[model samples]
Target: MSKAIARRGIMLVLSSPSGAGKTTIASRLLEDPGIELSISHTTRPKRKGEKDGKDYHFVDRETFTRLRDQDAFLEWAVVFDNYYGTTRKPVEEALAAGRDVLFDVDWQGARKLRESAKDDVVAVFILPPSAAALEQRLRTRAEDSDDVVKRRMRGASNEIQHWEEYDYVVVNTDIDQSVASVRAILAAERLRRTRLSGLKGFVQTLLATL
Candidate 1:
């Protein structure tokens, strides 16, 4: 008799300081085959090039609060004075369909995910090599006000403090290397025997052939 193919999915989380190359790594990962980005619902103003449902599902504060009250989000966090949440339904559906999800969020969101769905999660924390380098990157971007830059710098220290909590940590010394490292982690995770949901059925079929 052949066994059924188990359904499984991966929750790949990448977190970092404001300029720690996490976003770059995440962008590259999204291009990989069969990887889906977790579209978070947020109560924050969209920046240039950001879009609703693609970048984030922008919503009013009342809507966000209502969802939270209803226990709808798998994970939610308040960052930079903005509310960001990952809805439970879509992630649940994707996992049941055996598609991996990539999450680009901070430590708070990561922790929340772990608490809510530890079985399917694999978190990776990215760090800047040095505070000076991080500051330089922030300044180069020219995206934030001076006050916001300082706020992020302070937030970096707090974010880095939770490095030990993640499943993996990558010091983003080089963009290519960092991306490669994360890719390797993904490859390794995909190889986990338990995650090979259809292998049992295939092996059983092979035995019948023999």
Candidate 2:
């Protein structure tokens, strides 16, 4: 009997402007058994119903700073006056164990991850259909103040500019469709020849048998 070839795990990253449905898509993708979400550390206050080490690893400014100083984060960034970071240790362990890790971060974090782990990173950018639609989604959520919403709208243009940097782009006009597109991307990325770590040995063994 032939042994199965081993493969390395992927670092799947999703990024979008505020209210672009990236978070929703990321949540749905987590249902897949092949990938696990990377729990991020943040200085932002936990919202209602949020759990520690689940939604985010909430930490104080001092703690966050200490981790940052120690180079413990794979990627870290400041957003809306709060520090958010993906820790290095857990993600490294997951990848080493052949478990794909999902990252829901902004473009800055995505760039850093790609730089740090070029071969393992697969980045996707999500975009809202239009400016009007983006604003409408933000208003419908009712989670942010009018002033904050307006600020986000202003920042959206800047965020969209980085879309070309990602490996794939998905327009989030329909949630189900967007999710499907991302799932396809993940499936294809997993099969890339470079990622199949043991393929060379497997092929050599097969050739020997012949």
**TM-scores of the models, in the order given:** 0.94, 0.96
Compose the digit string of candidate 2's lDDT tens values, residues 19-124: 9999999999999897999999999999787899999999999999999999999899999899999989988888887789999999889999988898899999
Q: TM-score of model 1 relative to the true fold?
A: 0.94
RMSD of candidate 1 to the true fold? 2.5
lDDT of each: 0.91, 0.93
Q: After superposition, how far is residue 14 of candidate 1 from its true place, in Å?
A: 0.6
What is the alpha-carbon lDDT of model 2 when measured against the actual structure? Answer: 0.93
* The candidate that achieves the highest TM-score relative to the unseen native structure: 2
Residue lDDT tens for model 1, 1-210: 123656488999999988999988999999898789999999999998898889999999999999999999999999988999999998999888888999999999999999999989999999998999999999998989999899999999999999999999999999999999999999898777778788888888889999
lDDT of candidate 2 at residue 13, scale 0 to 100: 96
Alpha carbon lDDT at 114, candidate 2: 88
In model 1, the runs with Cα more than 4 Å from the true position are 1-7
